[model samples]
Target: MIVRIMGEGQVRLDDVHLAELDELDDELLAETRSGDEEGFRRTLGALLDAVRRLGAPLPDDALEPSELILPSPDATLPEVREMLKDTDGLIPG
Candidate 1:
């Protein structure tokens, strides 16, 4: 009930606060307070896996791991140059 209510945004939360809330899992917030280590570890592992999955590349035979596939249909020269600035020579454009 609390999770559903929180999810529905009855209360405001920051990213770090939400992350801590996820870690607590209804346990006390004090650092000295003992927590369910096994449960926390499992939850953390699952979260990490989910983040990795989210960052995974799309299904493409020619796509390499370092490739930065843009979502734009038609990118302007300035846009392409901006993206390439940080990438150095990773992209040939």
Candidate 2:
């Protein structure tokens, strides 16, 4: 799966990682819903970190469509909330 971290480049993640990413996605949604700013930041950082650690970074010039799009590391909670409202959390179930 191709995942895009906004403000960063794209990553080509294996399908096997989806389950783990989903768990983090769930945590992110929960944190956002509860208005836990600290938790939201932490979880979002973790999610982005996990993607960087587990997935291979695509070249900056790559133009493949991303299967999932995650907020940038510095994204605000309100921005994330608006993003979530338009779709499911970062990863689709």
1-93 per-residue lDDT for model 2 (tens digits): 899999998999999998998999999999998999999999999999999999999999999999888999999999999999866687888
Q: How many residue pairs clash in each candidate at the backbone level? A: 0, 0
Q: Write the residue-wise lDDT of candidate 1 on 1-93 in tens digits.
A: 011121111222233334443443222112112344444345434433333333433343322333222313233334434543544221122
Task: Give lDDT for model 1.
Answer: 0.31
Give the Å shift of residue 36 in candidate 2: 0.4
The number of the candidate with the highest lDDT is 2
lDDT at position 48, candidate 2: 98
TM-score of 2: 0.96
Best by TM-score: 2
